[model samples]
Target chain A: MNEALLAELRAALTPARVRTGATELGLYRRDASNIEGSAGVVCFPRTTEEVQACVRACVRHEVPFVPRGSGTGLAGGATPLDHAVVIALTKMDRVLSVDAVNRSAWVEPGVLNLDLTRQVAHLGLHFAPDPSSQQSCSIGGNVANNSGGPHCLADGVTTSHILAAEVVLTDGSVVVLGSEAWETHGLDLRGAFVGSEGMFGIATKLCVRLTQNAPAVTTMLMDFESVDAGAHTVSAIIADGMVPAALEMMDQLCIQAVEAYIHAGLPTDAAAVLLVEVAGLPHGVAADAARIVEIGTAHGARSVRIAQDEAERALLWKGRKTAFGAIARIKPNYYLHDTVVPRRALPDVLRQVYEVVERHDLLVLNVFHAGDGNLHPLLVFDKREPGVMARVHAAGEEIVRISVEAGGVLSGEHGIGLEKRDYMPLMFAPADLAAQAAVRRAFDPTGLANPSKVLPSPAGCGDLQHVPEGAWV
Target chain B: MIDLLAFAAEVGDAEPVTITGLGTRGGAVPDVRVVRAPAGIDWVQADEMTVCCGAGTPVDELVTELAAYRQTVALPAGGTVGGALAVGRADARQLGWGPVRDALLQARYVSAAGEVVKAGGPTVKNVSGFDVCRLLVGSHGTLGFIGEVILRTRPLARHSQWFHRADVHDPSDVFTTLYRPVSVLWNGSAVWVLLEGHPDDVAEQAAVASLVACEGPPALPTGSRRLVPPAQVPLLTGGFVAELGVGVVHHAEASDAAVRPERAQVLDHTVRQALDPSGRLNPGR
Candidate 1:
């Protein structure tokens, strides 16, 4: 059966674009995640018509197909379980059109997030969502994951930025889910299609909403004696009626590693540091910057320093987004958990996160968009260590539980893919999950689309999954 | 307290149900077992900048409550929160704020199966699963019975002023001249600009645009709302008030032209089938 499906896929899209060899399948089995799955065949499709053909071929062969973009997802969303067909979209990269008058652009799904922003910079507008992997991550992946970054605190996530999407449904039929106009009548399938983690379908062409650049931008760094102090300062800034363009926090462990990697001198001794940015008109930005500094000082900040020039501002952001890359300096592997709690609960959540890490005997780094109360607690450890993976998973579960208990969701942006599928029950009741499953079935009734990624095993009859014992199972 | 289960029970065994808010949207009330979502504010998280309210809560009331905390939600005036959401209306401030969907953080609704289901989190950034919350925003109450909602709030601007400019060759020129404007509205003959920011900032942009201070936004003759491509809004002709940069125009009188089609797409039929297979929710919505 597998051989027959491979032959059909190779026929649908010339053999040069279809690969069933063991080596190619090995590379397509997993995303940036640690867990590994199986891939039956990998097809590189370059156009919307080609993508539709691939889906049609997979459906006829009765094989599950997963849409992949750069494979930068950390939650194993691109992992093709059940020997699924991998429709890699890296070759579809292109900026198709730009409507500068309406502040909207049409780009292929494979266009990198940062590349889209850079391509439209001359027009005085840029794409909003900036995932940490923006340099390499595709807009298709951002659409799939509903990705968010530090700037999402001020701007909405990918869903709000995407005005429309041309999606190939599971039945191999192409449909335009939204429109270029500000308002689209009828059910918002476009909103439902995005962030489905490939469960609904694949987005081929995207009409992305471009954000106008602010006239003034100010980036500031504030150091605190302790993580608690830094957490409180975040709350104080928000309480002072200021939502900056971006507000990020980093612990000492993260500070040390990032400084070592970039040599930017990021207060290696301070227990916590904040990187805050506010941008708007010059007069408003000045007032916002001054108020943020005042709030930081009121919360026992050691010093609040403002970046004098654009170069300094860019360097400060570089130190923040390069945080994951700095993990290699401390440990060979890192298991990160993305959860969000109320800003007032940040200090307590951080304290519990530290306790859990210590009890598990793991080194950790903390860096995340603190303004939104999102937490990215990285449990750094060596995988070669016996029984270390088990402890890491256990500690991760505990962190998620505490965040939920503190009126938080399971994830802020990474999504409930393979990483937190089981924990979904902790946040949603049975009916809620059923409703989500029904929505999934609405778009992909056959369930030939990426299966067992977002929903837990046996969400409903429509989903096809070979239920395993655990994450690696 | 609102009993979502009760609403679901009322929808027992696939009986058609229609949601009704205050009579603010007066025309012809659908004849059915009308179910009104809960009314009044549930809680206000001032620090978190979020507010939870029953869907039927009056917009003016919610605005007043949020004003106490010096926060605001972008909702059209003179309607229930649910009424504004049912028709998918957004205030003109969306020029500065984003789409109304961005503020709708969570929703609790009743499925056709008499099941109480919820989507989204009260938190600002949530991507744990499919965004059913936003999907329900403009569904016209066809999918489910929207009971309650959680909306993100923003700090009230320090200063707000409305200005008018006449003989404006184009609204685009007026929009480009302002550094950061809350809204720019244009009728057939005149343009209106609303600026919200620090007094100095608003004053600076007003001077740059050379707009005369006005008491309020210019009102146009009442008519059906028309939606066109944002770029094509300039082509629209009539006694109407059009939101600049946004493609919505309130025309002077009803037009025979149909803006949206009546045919439902495959996904629409599929979602309607999946959620309300028995056609229990507002039919033909």
Candidate 2:
């Protein structure tokens, strides 16, 4: 690290907020993606002004920087680069204000996703984007990923709920994109910025839309003899014009793992299970739930279990959210692939996913947002086994290719950070990639903000670099 | 279309180029050459609740075509598909549906340098890139010309309207009490509520609303302006219509207030330059 640059950073922010010790740098190096990278230093900014000051110091020193929230991103989006500074925004967690009339709240980027819902639950309103890691992930991270959850099937993603953001640009300039109003004139820069994966700049504050709590909610779990049956049921429910608040699916492997770990009452004998929830007025919710149950039964559901109370409902969701973590009981390491296909193509895609993994001699478990056809196929492997990692990577790539071939996307919620950066070409052509790079250059002309992520480093594209092998899991 | 691309490439380094679609939003550019949509390119294709159409297709014609499938775009009646996407406005029934941008599943457009670029795909849920499909929406033709768009459509709602004359202050209560109204419009002196859904559901919701409202002499108000934040609806002195659930408001009279684009940072300008290096497309709009 440059001593002069360190001094400048220390001067801009208090010495207590700036840390250069190896221990501190190590703590900020890795995220939930399990990818590790080295950092020059980690600075925790307590306010937007402090964040701006830290950015300015990096700009003046010509040092690359990465802004991070809770570091819960699964895509290594918050991973730091070697010789770069990690500006962690954890200390800036605070809800600035809540406008119940407008059904919106102003909060710092570091505010945890679920904390916002807890704060406004008393007013009969809540934030709708409930990612599996909502308890630990920051709103800023959610915005960075445009995070989606099961409820996103009906409520939309994080970008849909975000009203505006106060962002600190690369040169340390502060600009507000979007507004508290429902709509804004000019370019929808806020829409562009939300899912940029921190390449553009750091969002200091976010004005997020809040949704009213439904007067009634019905949660149910249905078991099927085969994955195709469950998938068909999902398509049938949607085709019937019933939009459930949340619809998720877990395969036999995922169900066995969750049942073994938490005893969530999942049927161990079932080939697949669909967890469905509907929310609205009492009559509407009841009607929708009945219709969903009818459809599931028609599609060969072995059994349909409706939650008798909120506690049971919570327990059911706990099983679904912890399905990823429960996979730990099966394999020491797993690479979760996020992709989406048309609802009608779910069955065909699942078969292809199974074939790819089977050919590789890998055990892959399926748990995903069924309503939106966002599949999370977890490839389970033991890294200690010789050549297992290579097989996992190949299978993961095949799944992505197949999903895109089925008219889906490279990613659904987890962003195209270091993990999927090179695979972007599978979904986009050279000209499309160049257009996106232009957008990135428009924001970070210096290429000093979260470099080597999102768009690939095309030739002569400024100082953009590739994610080093050290940054991979 | 190939000729247009060739022309654009020929003039890549010259002044910015303007793209015109049906010439609906405004007349021809003052000083720039306008590239109109090619002949015989206006077409619409619908499949499984999704519609893909050329940018030059008029919104009215597209709506009529989608009506055969009992589907529709959540955009107003006028303007071309490209123009509607360029402006990116949400209709009065936004509460039941969504904004125009949300309906955009995929798009293909020509950059100022004549490179045909595509973002997103023909899928309902996609998070591939930065969602360039949405980024292009409401771009006001500054970035590039929207050549084609694929949109997710919704089943047309069975429409019904109910009007009640009441001097209600702070109409937020109606949103809290009513159940899933398609639109709640306040015309200054009275409120006009539109409901659309299954006949039984709509009638039930309307009855519940009517119980709280006392019928009176009808009053008509004109020159309404739309506002977004429901909290700001009470602040507007004139009569306005508030889509209670959607948090959109329409005032009785138009206001000259404008959000200054100059407030945007250097990044926005940089993006504009990258997409239209020659500053040719809707320059300085």
Candidate 3:
């Protein structure tokens, strides 16, 4: 980074808050993805005003800036490319205010996702979007990715839960998208901004709508003799007119990995397992659970187990959420893909996914949200292996292609960051992509918020961001 | 179903056009040409829980067809699907149905550049690109002429019925006490709660809340609806029917401040201009 820009960043944010050391900058380079980027300098913004100051300085210096939260994103959305200024928002963590009567809360961008639910537990309300990494992922990151969790099957995704956001645009001006009031006017700019991959602006504060706790809950685990049976049960459950709070599936590979790690009593002998949870009134929950179990049994489920208490429910969810971590038992590294296909096309898509993995000579685990058909196929391998990444990339691309061919999308929750930027053309036409570019241009006319992120490279959206002289990708 | 690409050509051939369906809300507008979708009930993916229809499809007709499959989209049935979207109609069941915009999953519309563009996709949850479908909703057709839309559909509740509680001061309390109410409407005097769920669950909630079964939902008087803060619903003097938790009030009289979220005029103008550079889609609606 140039000394002059460093001085300006240091002056705006105290010298202690702005760090340009190689060791510290290395930590800010990449998120959880395999891709890595170099950061020009990093600045810690404690407030929205501080965020605005950082944006203003970046704008004046004509340098691009990336807003980073917990750095838990897997799609590389927070990867600072071309030595962009990294404005870390971790210090702004705070649940600013809670309106219990209205069942809404205003929180700073840096607050942890699960912590918001913990803070508001006493009010009998919780934030709805609970991505598996909710424990460490920041709500700002969730907002940027438009994250979805297991509960999002019934509760909807981050976009549905987020009521409004106070954003600092690329030009250093602040604007509020969406409205706190239910009746909004003009355009749904907030909806457009939610999953922009931080290319539009930075959300300083977010007003998230909290969902009321159901009167009753039940979590059940059903083991099937085959992946076909498990997928069949998922279709039957939804076809029966009851959307379970969550319906998750784990193939034999995932079951073995999870059982080895958590020992949550997952049936390793079964070919597949379905974790179905329902929440509502006591009678409704009971009815829904009974119907789901009946559907599972009819679909060739071998055995069914219901969580006896809250502890057991947590145990079942722990097994599901930690499925990714358990992949280390089979391989040292994994490349996960998020794609959604039609519910009925699950079997075909999985068959193709397995075929692709087998052809590429890689190990993959199928554990994903079955209710919504969002497949998270983990390609497990050792990165140290010679030419393993090439095979992983090939299989990953094929899975996405198959999913999109089955009337699916490029991404369901994990957004299209650097990983899927080039694949956007597969799903969208040149005109469709141009409209998206128009949206980004509407927010950041100079294309300097977080360039080369969502829209593919040849979208004709020019960027004025000054790439450093020697920064390499 | 309407061929949206050819429809875009039609829209492009006739520049500066006005498009609407039924012309119910504000009557017809004189223009170069008026257009409508030539399709209705294009497809209903019951397994995927999504329904696609043309812009000219009648909302009630689409609802009836979806109901046969035990599924329904959260769209108001008073007008055509496109008209309801262009006018951004709010449903009485919004308290539980969620925002109207959330129901739209994918939309195909004609852009200002005289081409067909698709936003979002067939899936219920997608983050591939910008949510231009959402921006098209409630836009009053200034941005583009919507051709067809695919909406996320939910199961039709089994036992949905309305009950009324009289002499209610603050509807927010009742809103907090109920469990997954379909809708809660307050017409200045009585609070009507529409509970939809299993028969036993709805009955128990109704008994617990001490509500009396009413014939139907509260009716809104002849006027435009205003969106007040949920907390401010109780402070309204009178002459308004408020959706308790949803923060929409149907005032008996239309006031000047009637839910026009044009506070940030510059940003709104910039976003509008981004998609409609020629400013010819639905000029000066």
lDDT of 2 by residue, A285-357 (tens): 7778888888999999999999999999999998999988899999899888889888888999999999999
TM-score of each predicted structure versus truth: 0.96, 0.92, 0.97
Q: DockQ of each model against the real complex?
A: 0.68, 0.50, 0.72
Q: Give the per-residue lDDT digits (tens) of candidate 1, residues A1-473.
A: 37777777777788999987889999998888776889988999888888988999888878999999999888888988888999999999999999886788899999999999999999788898988989999999999999999999988789988888988887777888778767777777888988999999899999999988998999999999999999998988887778899999999999999999998868899999999999988888999999888888988899877898998888899899999999898899888788999998999999999999899898889999999999999889998999998898778878989999999998898877786777777788778888899999888888889987777755433331333334521
lDDT (tens digit, per residue) of candidate 3 on B190-233: 79899998889898899888898989886676686777667677
Indicate the TM-score of model 3: 0.97
Backbone clash pairs in model 3 (N, Cα, C under 3 Å; residues 3+ apart or in different chains), count: 0
Q: Write the per-residue lDDT of candidate 2 for residues B119-233, one digit (tens) a residue.
A: 7777666667776777788887778777777777776654455545367666666655666566665644446676655556666776766533334223333354454566666
Model 3, A68-156: lDDT tens digits are 99999888888998899999999999999998877888999999999999999999999999999999999999999999989998999
The CAPRI quality class of candidate 1 comes to: medium
Quick one: ranking by lDDT, best first? 3, 1, 2
Return the interface RMSD of the candidates, in order shown, one decimal each.
1.7, 2.6, 1.5
What docking tier does model 3 reach?
medium
Candidate 2: residue pairs that collide: B16-B279, B16-B280, B17-B280, B188-B239, B223-B252, B224-B251, B225-B250, B225-B251, B226-B250, B227-B249
